[model samples]
Target: MTTQPDHGQELIPRPERTPEAVRVALARVAPHRISDMERHKEQALTAAIADGKIGHLRHWLTYWQAQVEIERRPDLSARYRAALTAVHGTSSNDDPAFRSAMNELAAVEAEAQRAVSA
Candidate 1:
């Protein structure tokens, strides 16, 4: 079963960087994305096997490990999306909203990094 952090907790210990771990975490926190994740995994595996290189699979695992950190945290996920929206919605970097959004995005990314590294 997928595990979630207790209320008020901001991080969960980094998950094992494996497809099975990613799949289980996705199932727990982002069930709707499981199909897409599986599809990406299939493509990564196929490309890795065809190329006789493991880089493709490694990239997939690394990318998803960070993603699961955010997906598993509802507050962070909302902040991430809002920051993206603010960044996209503003045309000028000088805009206060844009600056604020950039700061928020950086914070969210930092938190995600810490969660993954923890």
Candidate 2:
């Protein structure tokens, strides 16, 4: 039988090597919105996969992993609040200041699809 390592030992802490966008986004979206965020994430991942953006896939995976880890923590919801405060505009769906931001992002995403096809 093998003994487990010490609790203090570092064996690859979560959110390891994830992009700031993903890490921060996971932290920013509301706890209730996490499921929605995850859905959007899956869409992005599917798009990235279809487009052969392997790098983006890795980032998505890292983001998903971090999200799972975060959700497990008791303070995960608070972390999301802090993230929202830090990256105010990226959350196109929730902000009142940027009324059209969500629409604009949707348009941009659509354009990206068209561009990929073209």
Candidate 3:
């Protein structure tokens, strides 16, 4: 049991031991608690690819890496990696365009990481 001051009048404090109340509070906070890097990494990559902003093969690779690293979602990561494989072709991972795209995506992902850290 606890007491709280209400403008100098004493009032009974609410108990903090309710499991249902705690769950509700956590649910309300979960979205803000999720790291921005984890939430936005895939959205950014999906937007870049859909908008033709990715200029090289490397963009796809770096995007895939971020999906693996930041997202850490195996199902979604596998799809992104498969798309990358389709775009750059397994035999031509050495392609320059692919490399450029991957590098550009890496830069974008690095910025996102900094943002999330901040």
- Candidate 1 residue 29 C-alpha distance from true site, Å: 0.8
Off by over 4 Å in 3: 1-91
- Candidate-wise lDDT, in order: 0.79, 0.47, 0.41
For 31-118, candidate 2 gives per-residue lDDT tens digits of 4655665676688778887998876666565545545344433344244445445446555646664445445434434432332223
**Which has the greatest lDDT?**
1
* Top TM-score model: 1
- List, residue by residue over 8-83, the lDDT tens digit for candidate 3: 2212222232333322332333334235434444566677778877543334334333332323323333444555
Segments of candidate 1 deviating more than 4 angstroms: 1-7, 10-14, 88-107
lDDT agreement of model 3 with the native: 0.41
**What's the TM-score of each model vs. the native?**
0.67, 0.33, 0.27
Task: Count steric clashes of candidate 2.
Answer: 1
lDDT of predicted model 2:
0.47
Return whichever of 1 and 2 wins on TM-score. Answer: 1
Q: What ranking of all candidate models by TM-score puts the best one first?
A: 1, 2, 3
